[model samples]
Target: MANRLQHETSPYLLQHADNPVDWYPWGEEALEAARTQDKPILLSIGYAACHWCHVMERESFENPDIAALMNQHFINIKVDREERPDLDTVYMAAAQMMTGQGGWPLTIFLMPDGKPFYAGTYFPPEDRSGMPGFPRVLLAVAEAYRNRRADLERAANDIQGHLTEHFRWSLPETAITPALLNEAASGLARQFDEANGGFGGAPKFPPPMALEFLLRYRLRTGSDTALRIVELTLERMARGGIHDQVGGGFHRYAVDATWLVPHFEKMLYDNALLARLYTLTYQATGHPFYAATALDTIEYVLREMTSPDGGFYSTQDADSEGEEGKFYVWTPEELEAVLGPEQAPIVARYYGVHPGGNFEGKSILHVPEAPESVAAAFDLTIDELVEIIGPAREKLYAARAQRVWPGRDEKILTDWNGLMLRALAQAAIALGRSDLRDAAVRNATFLHTHLYRDGRLLHSYKDGEAKITGYLADYASLIAGLLALYEATFDVRWIAWARDLTDRAIADFWDNEGGAFFDTSADDAPLVARPKDAFDSATPSGNSLMAESLLRLGLLLGEDDYRQRAMTVLERFAALAAKAPTGFGQLLCAADLALAEAHEIALVGDPQVPAMAEMLAVVQQPYLPHQVVALRHPDQDGEDEVIPLLAGRTARDGQPTAYVCRNYACRQPVTTAHDLAAELGMAVE
Candidate 1:
C-alpha cells in the first residue's frame, strides 16, 4: 500500500511513496500516531539527492520482512531535508553531538514526546564490515526500549542536557579588527594544501565560502598568500575530475586530495557560489578561462536545473539505482566504442583516459595535458585545436545525454533560489547579458507571486503549492538576492521589495531582547524550542547574512533604522565571533564590509549610452560587495535619492562622468576609467 508520502509535494517524500515500509511524512498525524500507540518513532531524514539515501531505501525500506518489523515497533516518519531544514538542523546537531559524526540517511529512535534517544547513519541490511545490520539493530533497540524504558529515558534526558549546554555558550564582547582577520587567514594558510590547493586532507569539498573570505581578506590587506591560495584551489578544481570538463558544472567534492575522484552529486548551491567566484576572478584578472568557466556553469544550470516557472531546482542525485556515479563514469571500452578506433586513442590521451583507470576501472574525464601542450602535440593553431576538442566533447555529451539521467529533486527551495538568483543577476551585470538578467527578474517575480502570502514568504514550492512558513535563512537569502537583482538592473521595484521583506523579517524573526534572529518565526509551528541559528555551515547563518543585507539595504534606501538594526544584531553576536572565526566566514565578510570605508558611484545619463555602459561594466567586474552603484537617467524623472551616496554629487562634467564618494564626501567628477580606477586604488589597465 502507498504511504502518506504519496500525496506530498516534496520530491524526496514522493521518492519513498512506493516503499514497502509504511512511512508517514513528518506531521501532526505521525506524531499523534506515535503518542497514541505508545510506540517510538523511527525518524529517517535524508534528501532526494543523497546517494546513500537511495542505497538504504533499496536495501532495507523495500524489503517486506524489514518493513514488517519496522511497522510493528515504530511509527516510521520521513523528512525531506531540503523542505524542513529546521528539523534537519536540530537532529543533525544532536546526532553529531552523540556520535561525533553525522551524514544523510540519518536514522534516529525518538520517544513519543519527540526527543531522540539513539541516532546513526547508513546501516546496512546485514551486519558487515563491523557495522550492525539494520534489521538486527532495529530488533535490539525495540527490545531494549521495552525492557529498559528507564535507561532509554535517562539517555534521552542526558542528550537534551548536552544540547542545552552547547547552545548556552555566550558571545564575547571584543570588537573585530584587521589583526583578527589576518590571524584567521594565517590559521587557514597553515591548513591549506600547498601542493594541490584547498584545505586539509582527503574528501576535498570546495570551501567556496573560505575562498570568498580569503579573496576579501586579500583585497583588504593585500595578502598575496591569500590570493595565491584562492587562485591555486580554483585552478586545480577546474582542471581535475571534480569539474565536468564537457558538461560544465562541478561535482560535489573530490574524495582525494588531488581534486580527482569526486562523489558525483551536483548541488545547486555549490554551482551558484562557484559561478560568482569565477565571475569575480575573471573581473580581477581578466582571465578568459575564468570567465568561460563561469558562463559554462550558468549555462548548465539554465539547461538542466531551471523550472518551467524560472526558479532553479534543488539538486541532481549522486546515484542511479544502488550504484554511485553509475550514470556518469565511463569505462575505457565504452569510450573506445563511442569514439571509434581511429579517434579513440587521441581522445583518450587528451582526456587522461589510460589503460589503468583513474577511478574504479572507469574513466572520469580530465585534462591530461594543458591546452598549449595539446595544441603543440597536434601541430594546430590554438583556435583550431579548440574547435576540434569542442566538436569531440559535443559528441560525447550527446551520447551521455542519451543514457539514463540521474534523478532530479525538483523542489524549489526559497533559500537555494535566492542563491541562484543572486548568481544569475551578478553574471548578467558582469557578462553584459541582458537575457540572464531578465531570467533572474522573472524568477524573482515568480517567487513573489506564488511563494509569498500576507506579506510573508513560504519556504518551498512544488506541484503548484507553496508550503511551510519562511525561516530566517529563507528571508535573509531572498532579501540578499533581491538586493543583488536591484543593483544589477537598477530596478527600483526590486529594491522596494527587498526593503519590505527586510521589514517583515525584522518584525517576525528578530529577538529584540536577545539581539539575534530565530531560525523560524515566533508564531510558526512550534518545535522543541525556538532555535537560534548562529553557526555558518554549508550556507551562511541567517542572522549574519541578514545583518549584512540590512546594512546594504539601509545604505541603498537611506534608512537609518535599517542600518541601526543591523548594528544591533552584529553587536549582540560580536562576542561569539571572537572565539570562532572559521565557522563565521559570512558574518566576517559582512563585518569587514561594514568596517571598511565604502564607496558609492552614481552615473547620471542615458542608460543606453555607450560611455555609461562601459563605466558600469568596469565597476561590476571586480567583486565589490560593499560598494553600491545606481544609474539615473533624465527620462526616469522624479525618482527618490535611490543613489544615496551620490545624492548631491550630480553630473558636473559635460560628458558621461562618475561621481565617486566616501561617507557622503564627494570627490571631483571623473570622466574616464583611468581616473576612476586610480581614485578607487584599482589598476586601470
Candidate 2:
C-alpha cells in the first residue's frame, strides 16, 4: 500500500511509498501530530542514490513487524536530504555530536520541537557485527520516552546546546598574505599519497578543488612539485576503475586507496567539478590527455544525465537489478560474446581484463598499462591499437546498454546544474566545441527562465515544477556559472545577471555579526542550529565559492565593498586554512586570487571580424586563472557601460583592439593577437 510519501516530489521520498511503515513527509502536520499525541518522532533522512539507504529500507522499513512498532510508538517521518538541506544540516550536526560519526540513511529519534535526543546511521534488522538491531533499538527508545521522560529531555537539551554551538564561529583578526598560500600548499602536500595518487588512505574521493589549488599554485609560483601532484593524480584516476573508462564520468569515492574499486554511484557534481579541473589542466599544460578526459566526462553527462528541459539530473544509482555494480561489470565470457574472437583478446589485453576478474569474478575495465606498453605486448603500433580499440569499445558500450540499467535520480538541482554550467561554458572555449557552446547558452536560458524567480533562485526542479527556496550554495554557484558564461562568449548580460544574484546573496545569507555567510537564510524554517559550514567536502562550500565570485566581481565591476568582503573572508580563515589546506581548497584558491597580480582585460570591436576573432582567441586560450576579461561589441553601443573595465575603451582606428590593464591603468590598445599575447605574457606563433 502507498504511504503519504506517494505525493512527494523527491524520488527518494517516493521510493518508500510501498513500504509497510506509514511515513509522513516532514512538515507542520507531522510535527503537530507528534506534539498532539505526545509521541516522539522517528525521523529517517537519506537520498535517492544511496546504496545503504536502499539496504536499510529493504531490511527494516519493509518488515511488517518493524512497521507496526514504529506506527504505534512514534510519528514516523521521512526526508530527502537533497530537498531539505537545512534540516539535514541541523540534524547531521546532532548525529555527529551524539554518535561521533555520520553518513547517509541518518536515523534520529527526536522530540516534537525538533531537538534530537538519539541519532545513528544504518541499522540492520537483526543484531550482528556488534551493531544493535533496529527492532530492539526502537523498543528501548519507546520505553525510555514513557518511563524516563525527564532523562530523555535532559539529554536532548544538552545535545541541542552543543549542536548549536558547533555551527557558531567567529571571524578572527588576521592578515592574508602570500605566505599563507605557500604554507597551505605544504600542508596539503604533507598527506599526498606518494604511492597512490590522491591525498588520504582508503575511501579515496577525487580532490578536484585541491588539485585546482595546486594548478593555481604552479602558475603563481612556478613550482614543479605542485604541477606534478596535479598531473600524477589525474593520470592515476583516469587509469583506475573509479573512472568509467568504458563509458565516461567518474563514480563516487573508491573504497580503497588504489582507486581500483568504486561505490559506483555517479554524481553530477563530481563530474562537473572534475571536468572543469581537467579542462583547466589542459589549458595550463597543453596536454592532449587532459583534454580528451574532459571531453569524455562531459559527453557522459550529456548522454545519460541531461533532462529534456536542458537541466542536468542529479545522480545515477549504484545498484541495478538488486545488486551493486551489476550493470557495469563484465565477465570474460560476456566480453568475448560482445566482441568477436578476433578482437576480444586484443581488447582484453589493452583494458587489463583478466580471466580471474578484478571484481566479483567480473572485470571492472581499467587501464593498468599505458598504450605503448599494451601496443608492445600485442606487436602493434600505438596508432593501430587505438584504431582497433575505439570501435570495439563502442560495441561493448552498446551491449552494456542492453542490460537492466542502473536507476537515475531525475531531479534537476540548481546547485549541481550550476557546477555543470560552468564546465560546459568553459569547455565551449577551451575545447572549441560549438555544440557545447550552444548547449551552454540554452542551459543558461533554461535556468534563468525556470529556476530564477524575481530576484531569487529556486533549489530543485522536476517535471516542469520548480520548488524549494534556494540556499546560499545555489545562489553563489549559479552566479559562478553565469560569470563563466559571460567570459566564454563575452556576453555582458550574463555578467549583469551574475552581479544581481551576488547582491541578492549578500542581502539574504550574509551575517553582519559573524562577517561570513550562513548556509541558510534567516527567513527559512528554524532549526536546532543555523548551519554555516566552511570546509569543502564532496562539493565546494558556499562561502568559498562566494568568496571567489566576489573577488571576480570586484575586479570586473570595480566594487570596493565586494573586494573588501572577500578579503575579510580570506583573513578570517587564513589560520585554519594554513593548517589543513586540503579541506579548505576552494577558500585557499580564493586567497590565491586575493594575493596574485591582477589582470583586467578589455577587448573592443566586432568579435566576428578576423582581427577581433584572433585577439579574442588569444585571450580565451591559456589558463591565466586570475584574469578578468570583458568584451564590448561595437554594435551594442552603450550596452557595456555597466562594465567598468570597458570604460573609455575604443577599437583603435576602426580595427579590433585589446587592452591589458592593472589597477585601472591600460597598455596600448593592440590590434593583433601577437601584440595582445605579448601584453598578456604568452608565446604565440
Candidate 3:
C-alpha cells in the first residue's frame, strides 16, 4: 500500500510510496506527531539518482519486519535531499560529526525539536561485511532513546555545537594576491594525477571548476603547465568510458582512476559544467576535438534530459532493468549483430571492445586506440575515419535506444538549470550554433515565466508545479546564466533580469555578520542551522558563485557595493582556500577575477550590423575569462543610466565601434574588428 509519500511531489519520495515502511514526508504534521507521541524521529534522506539509496531501500525499507519495528518506536520521515538541501546540510554535518563519513541514503535519529542524536549511511537488512543490521540498529537506537535519553541529548548538543563551530571562518590576515593564485596553482599541480589525468586515486570525479580555475590561471600568467593539466584531463575524460562514446554525454563519475568503470548515473549539472568547460577549452586551444565534444554533450542533454517546457531534467538514474549499466554496456556478439562483420572489427578496435570485456563481462565503450592510430590501421585519413565513425555512432545510439532506459528524475532545479543555461549560452556564442542559443533563450524564458513569480524565483519545478523558496545557489547561478545569455544573444532584458536578481539575492541571503552569502535565504523557513557552505563540491557553493557573479556584474555596471561584497567573500575564504586549493576551485577563479586587470568592453551600435558583428566576433573569439562585454543599441535608453560602462560610448566615423576599457578607463574608440582586437590585446584575421 502507498504510504503518505503518495502525496509528495518529489520523485525520490514517490519511489517509496509502496514501501512496507509507513513513511511520512518531512513536514509539520510528522514533527507534531512525533512531539505529541514522544517518539524519536527516524529521518532518511536520499536522492532519486543515488545507487546505494535504492540498494538500502530494497534491502531494508521493503522488509515488513523492519518496518514494524520502525513504526512502533519512531516517527519515520523521508526526505529527498535535492528537494530540501537546507535540511540535508544541517543533518549531513551532524552525520559527518557523529560518524567519520557521510553519504546518501543518510540515516539519522532526531529529537522532536530537530536535533539529531545518531546518524549513519546505508545499513543491511542483516549484519554483513562488519556492518550492523538495520533491524538491530533500529532496536538498539530505540532502546537507547528510552534508557539513555540524557546521553543521546548530550550527544546531539555536542554534534550541533561542532556543526556551528566547523563552518565559522576567520578573516585572513593577508588580502588576495597573485602569490595566492601561484600557490593554489602549484598545489593543484602537485595533486594532479600525472599518469591518469585526474587528482588522487579511485572514484575520480570530474573537477570542472578546478579545471576552469587552471584555465584562468593559464590565461592570467601564460603558465603552460596549467594549460597542460587542463588539456590532458579533458582529453582523457573524452576518451574514457565515463563519456558515453556513442550517446555523447558523461556518466556521474568514474569509479576507477582510468575512467573505465563508471557509476552510470548522468546528472544535468555535470553535463552542463562539462559542456562549458569543453567549449572554453576549444576557445583556448582552437581544437576541433573539444568543440565537437562540447556539441555532442549538449546534444545529449537536449535529446534525453530536456522537458517539453524546455527546463532541463535533474538526473538519470545509475541503474536500469534491475541492474546497473545494463542499458549502456554491450557484448561482443551484440555489437556484431548491430553492425555487420566488416565494420564490427573496426568499431570494436577503435572502442577497445574485447571478448573478455572491461566491465563485468560486458564492454563499456572507450577509446583505447587514438583516432590517428585507428585511421592509419584502416588505411584512411582522419577526416574519412571521422565520417565513418559518425554514422556508426548514430547506429549504435539508435540500437541502444531500443533497450530499457535509466529512470530519469524529471524535476527541474534552478541552480542546475542555471549551470546548463550558462553552458548553452557559451556554446552558442563560441560555436555560433543557433540551436543552442534558441534552447538557452527558451529555457531563460521558461524560468522567467514559470519559476520567477512576483519578482521572486522558486527553486524547483515538476509536473506543472513550482514551489520552494529560492535558495542562494538558485539566485546566484540563475543570474550567472542570465549574464551569459545577455552576452550570447545581446538581449538587454537578460541583463536587466540578472541585475535585479543579484540585488534581490543580496537583500535576501547576504550574511552581513559573516561577510558572505548563506545557502538558504533568511526569509525562508528556519532549519537547525542557516547553512553557509563556501567550499565547492559537486556544484559551486552559493557564496562562491555569488562572489563570481558579483565581480562580473560589478565590473559591467560599476557597482561599488557589488565589488566590495565580493572582496569580503574572497578575504573570508582566503585562509581555507590556501589550505586546500582543489576544494575551493570556484572561489579561486573568483579571486583571480578580483586580481586580474578588468577587461570591460562597451560597444555602442546596432547589434545586427555587419560592422558590429565583426567587432563582436573579435571580442567573443578568445579565452578571456576575465572579460565583461556589454553591448548597447545606439538608440536604447535607460541602459546607459543603469550601466555606467555604456555611458558616453558612441560609434566612431559613423560606423559601429567598440570601446575597450581597463579599470573603467577607456582607450580610443575603434570602428573595425582588427583595431578592437588590437586594443584588447588579441589578434584577428
Candidate 4:
C-alpha cells in the first residue's frame, strides 16, 4: 500500500510513496501520529540526489522485516532537505554538535514533542566498515527509550540545551579595514593548493565564495597572486573530471586532490555560482575558455535542470541503480562496443580513457588536452575532429539516457533561484545574449509573483504551490539577482523592486539589537531557536551577500540609508570576520568596498547613441563589481554629476559623446569608442 507521502508535492517525499514502511511526509499528520501513539518519530532527512540516501533506502526502507520493525515502534517521517532547509539546518547542526560530523541520510530519533534525543548520519543495513548496523542501533535505541526512560530524557535535555545555546551569541562592534582584507587573502593563499588548484586537501569542493573574494581582492589591491589563484582554480576545474566535458556543468566536488574523480552529483547552487565566477573571470581576462565554460554551464541548466514553468530543479542524482557513477563512467570495452575499433581508441585517448581505467576501472570523461592536440593526434582538421567527437558523445549520452535515471529533487528553492538568476543575468550581459537575460527576468518575476506575498517571501515552490516562510538566504540571494538584472538591462523597475525587497528583509530578518540577520523571521515557524547563520557554506551567508547587495544598490540608487545599514551589519559581525576569514570572505569583500573608494558613472544621453552604448559596454565588460553606471536622458536630474559629453546629447546625434568623472570631477568629453574604452580601462581593438 502507498504511504501518506504519496500526496506530497516534493519529489523526495514521493520517492518513498510506495515503500513497504509507512512513511509520512513531515507535517502535522506525522507529528500528531507520534503524539497520539506515544511513540518516537523516526525522522529521515535526505535530498533526492544523495547517493547514500538511495543506498539506505534500497537496503533498509525497502526490506519487509526492517519495515515492520520501523512501523511497529516509530512514526516514520521523511523530509526533503532542500524543500525544508530550516528543519534540515536546525537538526543538522544538532547532529554535528553531538557527533562532530554531519552528512546526508540524516537519521534522528525524536520525542513526540519534536525534540531529538538521538541523531546520526548514514548507517549501514548490516554492521560493516567500522560502523554499526541500522537494525542494531534501532533496537538498542527503542530498548533504551522504553527501559531507561530517565537516561534518554537526560540526554535529550542536555542536547536541547546545547542546540538552544548555539543560536545565542552577542555580536562585537569591530571596524573592518583594508588591512584585514589583505590579511584574509594571505591566509587563504596559504591554504590554496597551488599545484592542482582549489583550497585545502582531498574532497575539494568548489569554494565559489573564496574565489569571489579573490577576484575582488585582485581588483582592489592588484595582487597578482590573488588573480593567479582565481585563474588557476577555474582553469583546473574546467579541465578536470570534476567538469562534465561532454555535457557541460560541474560535479559536486573532487574526491581527490588532482580533480580526477568527482562525487558525480550536479547541484543547482554549484552551477549557478560557478557560472557567475567563470563569467567574471572571462570578463576580467577575456579568456575564451572561461567564457565557453560559463556559457556551457548555463546551457546545461536550461537543457536539463529547468522546469517547464521556468524555475530550476534543485539537483540531479549522484547515482542510478545500485552503483555510483554507473550512468556517467564507462569502460574502454564499452567504448569499443559503441564506437568502431578505429574510432574507439581515438575517443578513449581524447577523453583520458585507458585500457585499465581512470576511475575504478571505468573512465570518467575529461578533457585531457586542447582540442587542437586531439585533432593533431587524429590527423584531421579541428572542425572535423569536433564533428566526429560530437556525434560519439551524443551517442553515449543517448544510450545513458535510456537507463534508469537518478532521482531528481524537483523542488524550486528561492535561494538557489536567486543564485541562478544572478548568474543568468550576468552571463547574458557578458555573452551579449538578450534571450538569456529574458529568462532571468522571467524567473525573477515568477518568484516575486508566486513566492512572495504580504511583505514576506516564501522559501520553496513546487507544483504551483508555495510554502514555508522565507529564510535570510532567499531574500538575500533573490535581491542580489534582481540587482544584477537591473544592472544588465538598466531597468529602474528591477532596481525599485530590489530596493523594496531589501527594505522588507531588513525589517523582518535583521537583528537590530544583535546587528546580524536571523536565518528565519521573528514571527515565522518556531524551531529549537532562531539561527543567525554567518558561515559561508556552499553559497555565501545571507548576511554577507545582503551587506554586499545593499552597498552596491545604495551606490547605484544614491541612498545613504542602504550604505549605512550595510556598514553597520559588517561592523556587527567583524569578530567572526577576523576569526574565520575563509568562512566570511564574502563579508570581507563587502567591507572592503564599504571602506574604499567606489566609482560611479552617470551618462545623461540617449542609450541608443553609439558612443553612449560603447561606454556602457566597456563598463559592463570588465567584472568591475565596485563600479556603478547609469544612462539617463539629458533632462533627468538628481544625479551627483552629469557628463558634459552627453549633456546636450540626443538620439538624433549621429555619434554619442561621453563624460567620465569621479566624485563630481569631470574629464574632457570623448566622442569615440577608443577614448571611451580608455576611460573605462578596457582594451579596444
Candidate 5:
C-alpha cells in the first residue's frame, strides 16, 4: 500500500511513497502520532537527487522485516530538505554537533516534540566498517527510549539548548576595510593547493563564491597571484571530468584532488553560480575559454533543465538504472560505434578516453589535450580540428540521447531560479546576448506571475501549484535577481519590484535588534529554533544575500534606510567574517561592495538611440563591480516613477548624456561614448 507521501508534492517524498516502511511526510500528523503513541519520531531528511538516499531506501526501507521494526517502534517521517530548509537547518546543526559531521540522508531520532536526541547519516542494512546497522541502531534507540525515558528526555533538552545557542552569535563592532579584504584574500591564498587548482585536499567542491572573491580581490589590488588562482582553478575544473564534455554544465563536485572523477549529480544552484563566475572571469580577463564555457553552461540549462513555462528545474539525479553514472559514462567501443573508427581515435585521445577506462571500466570524457597539441598531432590546423570535433560532439550527444536519462526533480524553487535569473540577466548584458535577456525576462515573469501572489512569494512551484511560504533566502535572492534584471535592461519596473520586496522582507524576516535576517519568517512552520544563516554553504547564506541585495538596491533606489540596515548587518558580522574569511565568501563580496568607493552612473537618453546605446554599452563593457547604473529615458516621464539618481538628469544637446558621480557628487555630463568612457575609467574602443 502507498504511504501518506503518495499525495505529497515533493518529488523526493513521492519517490518513497511505495517504501515498505510506512512513511509520513514531516507535519503535525506525524508529530501528533508520535506524541499520542508515546513513540520516538524517526526523521529522515534527503533530497530526490541524493544517490545514497536511494541506496538506503532499497536496503532498509524496502525490507519488510526492517519496516515492521520501524513501524512498531517509531513514527517514521521523511523530509525533502529542499522543501523545508528550516527543519533541515535546525536538525543538520544538531547532527553536525552530535556527529562532528553532517550529510544527506540525515537520520535523526526525535522525541514527541521536534527535538532530536540521536542523529546520523546513511546506515547500511547490515553492520559493516565499524558503523552500526540501521536495524540494530533502531532497536537500540527504541530500547533506550523505553528504558531510559527521563535520561533521554534530559539529553534531548540539552541538545535543543545547544542547537539554540548555536544561532546566538556575538556581534563585533568593526568597520569593513580594504586591509581586512586583503587579509581575507591572503588567508584564501594560503589555503590554495598549488599542485592542484582548488583549496585543500581531495574531494574538491567548486568554490564559486571563493573564486568570485578572488576575482574581485585581483581586480581591486591588481594581484597576479589572486588572478592566477582563479584562472587555474576554472581552467582545471573545465578540463576535468567534473565538467561534462559531451553535455554542458558541471557535476556536483569532483571526488578526487585532480578533478578527474565527480559525484555526478547536476544541481541548478551550482551551475547558476559557476556560470556567473565564469562570465565575470571572461569580462575581467578577456579569456575566450571562460566565455565559451559560460555560454555552454547556460545553453545546457536552456536545453535540459528549463520547464515549458520558463521555471528552471531543481536537480538531475546522480544514479540511473540503479547504478551511479551509468548514463553519463562511455566505453571506447561505444565511442567508436558513435563516431566511426577514424574519427573515434582522435576524439577519444582528445577527451582522455583510453583502453583502460578512468571510471569503473568506462571513460568519463574530459579535455586531456590542448587544442594546439591535438591539432599538431592530428596533422591538421586548429580550425580544422575544431570543425571536425564539433560535428563529432553533436553526433555523440545525439547517440547519448538514446540512453535513459537521470530522474529530474521538476520542482521550481524560488531561490534557485533567482540565482539563475541573475546569471542570465548579467550574462546577457556582459555578452550582448538578446536571447539570454529574453529568457531572463521570461523567468522573472514566470516567478512574478506564478510564485509571487498578493505581494508574497512562494518557495517551491510544481505542476502549476505553488507551495510553501517564501523564506528570507527567497526574498533576498529574488530581489538580487530583480536588481540584476534592472541593470541588464535598465527597466525601472524590476527595481520598483525589488524595492517592494525588500520592504516586505524587512517586515517579515528582519531581526531589528539582532540586525540580520533569519532563515525562517514569522509565519513559517515553527521549528525548534529559527536560524540566522551566516555561512556560504552549497548556496549563499540568506543573511549574506540580503546584505548584498540591500547594498545594491539601496544605491539604485536612493534609500538610506535599506543602506543603513545593510551596513548594520555587515558590521554585526564583521569580526566573525574577518576571522573566517574562507567560509564567508558571499559576506566578503558584500563587504567589498560596502567598502568600495562606488560610482553612480545615471545615463539620461532614449535607450533606442545609437549614441545612447553606445554610451550604455561602454558603461556595461568593463567589469565594474562597484558601479550602479540607472537609465532616465523620455518614455519614463512620470514624476513619481523617477529614481533618485535620474530625477534631475537631462540629455545634453538632445544627445544621450552620461552623468558619472562619486557618492552622488556629479561631474559635467558627457555626450560622446569616448567622453563617457573617460569619465567612467574605461578605455575608449
Candidate 6:
C-alpha cells in the first residue's frame, strides 16, 4: 500500500511512497500523530539524486521486518531535503551538533514535541564492521525513549541550545580593505594543491565561489598568482574525468584530488555557477578555452536539464540500473564498437581510455594528454584532430543514449532555476548568443507564471503544481536572475519584477533586529531555531545573495534605501567575512562593490540606433565587475516607468550618447564607442 507521501510533489518522497514502512510527509498531521501516539518520530531526510538515500531505502525502508518495527515503534516521517531546505538546515545543524558530522540520508529520532534526541546518516540493515544496524539503533532509541525519557529530554534540550548558539555571530567588525582581499588570495594559494590544481586532498569539489573570488581579486589588484590559481584550477577540471568529455557539463565532486574519479551526480546549481565563472573568466582574459567550456556547459543544460515549459530541473542521479556511474562509464570494447578499430585508438589516446580503465574496468573519459601532443602523435594538426574527435564523440554519445539513462529529478527549484537563469543571461551578453537570451527570457516567464502566486513566490514546482512558501534563497536568487535578465534584454519589466520581489523579500525574510536575511520567513513553520545562513556552501548563501542583489538593484534603481539595507548587511557580516573571505565569496563580492568606485553607464538614445550595437558591445566587452548599465530611450513618456540611473539623461546632439558616471559624478557624454571606452578608462580594440 502507498503511504501518505504518495501525494507529495517531491520526487524523493514519491520514490518511497510505496515502501512497506508507512511514511508520513512532514506536516501538522505527522506532528499530531507523534504527539497523540507519544512516539518518537523517525525523520529521514534525503534528496532524490543521493545514491546512499536509495541504498538505505532499498535495504531498510522497503524490508518487511524493519518496516513492521518502524511502524510499531515510531511515527515514520520522510522529507526531501531539496524540497524543504528549512527543515533540512535546522535538523542538519542539530545532527552535526550531536554526531560531530552530518550527511544524508539524515536519520533522526525526534521527541513527540519535535526535538531530536538522536541523529545519524546512513545505517545498514544488519550490524557490520563495528557499526550498529538500523534495526539495532531503532530498538535502542525506542527503548531509551520509553525507559529513560528524562535522559533523552535532557540531551534534546542541550542539542537545541547548541543549535541556537551556532547562529549567533560575535566576531568584531573589520573594515574590508585591499589587504584583506590579498589575505584571502594568499590563503587560497596556501591551501591550493599546486600539483593537482585544487585545494587540499581527496574528494575534490570544484571551488567555483573561491575561483570567482580569485578572478575578482585579480581584476581588482592585478594579482598574477590569483589569476594563475583560477587558470590552473579551471584548466585541470576541464581536462579531468570530473567533466563529461563525450557529453558536456561536470559530474559532482571528484573522489580523487587529481579530478580523476567523480561522484557522477550532476547538479543544476554546480553547473550554473561554474558556467558563469567560466564566462566571467573568458570575458576577463579573452580565453577561448574558458568560452568553449562555458558554451558546452550551457548546451548540456539545454539538452538534458531544461523542462519543456522552460524552468530547469533539479538534478541527474549518480546511479543507474542499481550501479553507480554505469550510465557514464565506458569500456574500450564499447568505444571500439562505436568508433571502429582504426579511429578508436586516436580517440582513446586523446581521452585516456585504456584497456584497464581508470574506474572499475570502465573508463571515465578525460584528456590525459594535451591536444597538441595528441595531434603530434597522430601526425595531424590540432584543428584536424579536433574535427575528427568531434564526430566520434557524437557517435559515442548516440550509442550511450541506447543505454538506460540515469534517473532525473524533474522538480524545478526556484533557487537553482534562478542561478541557471542568471548564468544564461550573463553568458548571453558576453557570448552574444541569442539562443541563451531567449532561454533566459523563457525561464523568467516560466517563473513568473508557474512559481509565483498572487504577490508572492513559491519555492518548488513540478507536474503543473507549485507549493511551499519561497525561502530567502528563492527570493534573492530569482531577483538576481531577473536583474541580469533586465540587463541582457533591456526590458524594464524584469527590473520592475526584481524590485517587487526584493521588496517582498525584505518584508518577509529580512531580520529587522539581526540585520541579515533569514533562511525561513518570519511567518514560516516554527523549527528549533530560524536559520540565517551567512556562509556559502554548494550554493551561495541566501543572505549573501540578498545583499548582492540589493546592492546591484539599488545602484541600478538609484534607490538609497536598498543601498542602505545592503550596507547594513555588509556591516553585519564584515567581520565574519574577513575572518574567512573565501567561504563568504558572495558577501565578499558585495563588499567589493560597496567599496569600489560605483560606475553607472546610462546610454541616452534610441536602442534601435545603428550605432547602439557598437556602444552596447563596448559596455559588454570590458570586464567591469562593479559597473551597472541602463538604457534610457529618448522616446520615454511620463506614463512609462523611469529608473533612477536613467533620470535626466538624454542624447547628445540628436544622436545616441553614452554617459559614464563614476561615484554619482557624470562625465561628458560620448557618441562613439571608442570615445566612451576612453571615458571609462578602457582601451578600445
Looking at model 1, residue 246 earns an lDDT score of 73
Report the C-alpha lDDT of model 4 over 67-104, residue by residue, as the tens digit: 99899889999998888777888888888987889999
How close is every model to the real structure, measured as TM-score?
Answer: 0.95, 0.98, 0.98, 0.92, 0.98, 0.98
Q: Which ten residues in a row have the lowest lDDT in candidate 2?
A: 164-173
lDDT of each residue in 125-151, candidate 1, tens digit only: 999999999999899989988999899
Count clashing residue pairs in model 5.
0
Higher-lDDT candidate among 1 and 3?
3
Backbone collision tally, model 2: 0
- Model 3: which ten-residue window has the lowest total lDDT? 165-174
What lDDT score goes with residue 28 in model 3?
A: 91
Candidate 5 lDDT (Cα, whole model)?
0.89
lDDT of 3 by residue, 541-609 (tens): 888989999999999988889999999999989767866888999999999999988789999888789
What TM-score, to 2 decimals, does candidate 5 have?
Answer: 0.98
Residue pairs with backbone overlap in model 1 = 172-575
lDDT of each: 0.82, 0.89, 0.90, 0.82, 0.89, 0.89
Cα deviation of 218, candidate 5, in Å:
1.0
Candidate 2 ranges with C-alpha deviation above 4 Å: 683-685
Worst 10 residues of 5 by lDDT: 634-643
> Candidate 2, 214: how far from true, in Å?
0.6
lDDT tens digits, residue span 23-57, model 2: 99999999999999999999999999899999999
Cα lDDT of model 2 overall?
0.89
The reply for model 1, stretches above 4 Å from the true place, is 568-582, 641-657, 668-675, 682-685
lDDT score, residue 473, model 4?
A: 93
lDDT of 6 at 662: 66
Higher-TM-score candidate of 1 and 3: 3
